[model samples]
Target: MTQSYKIVIPVFFIGFLAGAGFWYLFSPALFDRVVSEELPAGFDLSELRSGEFRDVDGAHRGSGKAQVLVSPAGAALLRFTDFEVTNGPDLEVWLVKDPDPQKSADVSASQWLSLGPLRGNKGDQTYVIPEGTNPSEWGSAVIWCEQFGVLFSVATLSEAKI
Candidate 1:
């Protein structure tokens, strides 16, 4: 191959790698979700609580409703509908004791339970709250950055009218 062609090929490969890395770190992950988890025999799906998400600050943005339900046998479920949030590395869903955490620090200092890693930045997703973890004990649901200690968004939960 010509020397010019060799140089151009290497440059193109490097550029592609850099672009992929940047997208991985900064771009949001999005996939519209549809849930269909089977409940145990005679499972009750009543007893639901829900909350609306709010931005953590000016740069961070989120809009959605978080719905929490406790099965009769004590398993909990967290579902997000029409949900969207700023994407970041190591994001995790949390249930915090504080009804309203004014800042990121408040979340770390308060009691919390990890539901799981965020499935997507924008989607309708459902996460199974581990068995024996009572979601009703806390009043807030959080989108937290585990790696950076950042609060992306939060939802202060309230009982959903039957």
Candidate 2:
């Protein structure tokens, strides 16, 4: 109603909008997403070979349990539980020969097989490794960003003493 009040309100609204836009664009990886999927009723966890996720390149954080489980009929799956990690665009799950990769070049520097595009940046997920490919041959698992060539995280695979 006052002359100064009208001008001040518009200026404040514009500033708020600008700040929100900047936050959304610049801090994409900070967002957290949780997704859930049901496992097959007959799937057995007893036969799984398990591993623990680790951070790499000082650009990633968070940890979780990784397991390679086989179905009763003989299909292989990579499962992640209690999983947490930073979010990034074009992130794909990769099984790699190198246990610790510092950059994108290292991803292709040796033999690598993609489990598939990452299901979610945070929470439990599963991936099916191609039937003929041997999971034992790969040393570790990597959450890689295909578009920007960034390694989000890595997990070294090892046999679990079940």
Highest-scoring model, TM-score: 2
lDDT of the candidates, in the order given: 0.83, 0.78
lDDT of 2 at 160: 64
Query: What is the TM-score of each predicted model, taking all chains together?
Result: 0.75, 0.76
**Each model's number of backbone clashes?**
0, 0
In model 1, the worst 10-residue window by lDDT is 30-39
Give the per-residue lDDT of model 2 (tens digit) for 4-28.
Answer: 9899999999999999977865566
User: Residue by residue across 1-162, what tens digits does model 1's lDDT show?
Assistant: 698998999999999999998887766544332344333456577657899999989877789988897776677788888888887788899999999997899998999998888877877777788887777778899999998899989999988887
Q: Model 1: runs farther than 4 Å from truth? A: 1-24, 28-43
**RMSD each, Å:** 4.0, 4.9
lDDT of 1: 0.83
lDDT, candidate 2, residue 123?
82
